[model samples]
Target chain A: MASRMRIRAKAADGVTEVKALMSHPMETGQRKDAEGNPIPAHYITEVTALHNDKVVLQAYWGAAVSQNPFLHFRFKGGAEGDTVTIKWVDNKGESQSDDTKI
Target chain B: MNHHRRTFLKLGGAAFGAVATAALWPLRAIAAAVRPNAAFEATALDGAYKQLGGTPAESADIDLSTPDIAENGAVVPVSVTSKLPGTEAIYILIEKNPNPLAAGFMIPEGTEPFVSVRVKVAQTCNVIAVVKAGGKLYSAAKETKVTLGGCGG
Candidate 1:
């Protein structure tokens, strides 16, 4: 599958700030369809961020997160041209990863 | 001969069980470290805090920012930054949501104690940011009035 994340990492003053937007349904399982059928819960459960193959940040999310989630964070020791990767695994066990240069 | 065969079958079963556990140990550990499922399943603020294993004291050092009023409850912008030293984790909780715990971010060494995300609020409620610093829990809260509920159809 294609990358589901749009990521931007900028290095400035010895810190790399990373911002990512993930495309996800984030269904809370409480909403209903047109026929009033309940939607099953499907949301990203874990997100991991890596800087130059080293883990930097990890996030755990619930269905309360909005659809198409956005995350912003910063880490030190990352420089320009270093690799920053963002990966997420949902409750259904599906996973996606995308990387970019800082 | 029958007794010997039964003993052999029991040994084989035990060996298979050991192999399965060895194969799954790391995966289970990683899952537990990455996601605290009990905390996410909590339906109230106190329940969530209990699952997280601490009572958070209100702190001014944790800066929590949210809009005064959210026109759309489906997506309310929230951000938190902890000024306390040794800040390890940050948790976002919406008091009125069906489940109070919305998200948790682990801030490893060298990472800033700041996070930003958007969350669904069921109704007008208080958005709380709890920070774990130096093995203690600190939190700050802000109220956001939602014009529409986010969880209903």
Candidate 2:
């Protein structure tokens, strides 16, 4: 399946910075539709960032995270041409991953 | 012969149970580690804190940045940086949200204790960032006024 994430990784001075934007509804289950029925909760539950297969950061998120979530972080020991990957799993068990070069 | 057959059947059942448990162990562990459901379901700040099992002290070493006024409550930009040594994790909480806990991040070795993300603000409230370092919890907070609520119809 095509990934719903856009990732960018850059290396400088022995450090690598990663920024990712993911597409998700992030419904809080508190809102009602036009018909007045409650919307079911749908949100990303977990996010993992890996540098060359090594897990560097992991995020656990709730419904309060904004729609189309944006995340930014940095880690050491990444060089140019190294691979960085971002993977996310939502509450419904749907998962996607995307990788980019630093 | 009948007694020996019964014993063999019992052993087979026990072995099957053991295999089933072993197969499910990793999935259970991964689910628990991936999502702290109790923390996220907590509706109050204290409940969220209790779920996290931390008594955090107010700290100056943690920097929490948010706009003084959020024009749109639907998407408020927030960032946190921990200057504490050996920082292992960071958590974000919105004090007035229906569920106070918003997000938590695990910082592995060689990773910087900094993160930026957008969150939904239910109302004007304090946004707190908690950092776990060296087995201690430290926190910093900032208030942001919201013109409209985010979590309602």
DockQ value for model 2: 0.78
Say which docking band candidate 2 falls in.
medium
True contacts kept of each: 0.92, 0.93
Q: In candidate 1, what are the lDDT values of residues B72-141, reduced to their tens digit?
A: 8999999999999999899999998999999999998999999999999999989999998887899999
Candidate 2 local lDDT, residue A87: 93
lDDT of each residue in A1-102, candidate 1, tens digit only: 254589999999998999999999999888889898998999999999999888899999999999999999999888889999999999999889999999
Query: Per-prediction count of colliding residue pairs?
Result: 0, 0
* A21: Cα error in model 1, Å: 0.6
Cα lDDT tens digits, model 2, A1-102, are 254589999989988999999988899899999998999999999999999999999999999999999999999989989999999999999888989999
Residue-by-residue lDDT tens digits, candidate 2, B1-153: 999999999999999999999989998646435577899999899999987876699999999999999988889999999999999889999999999999999999999999999999999989999898887888999999999787744
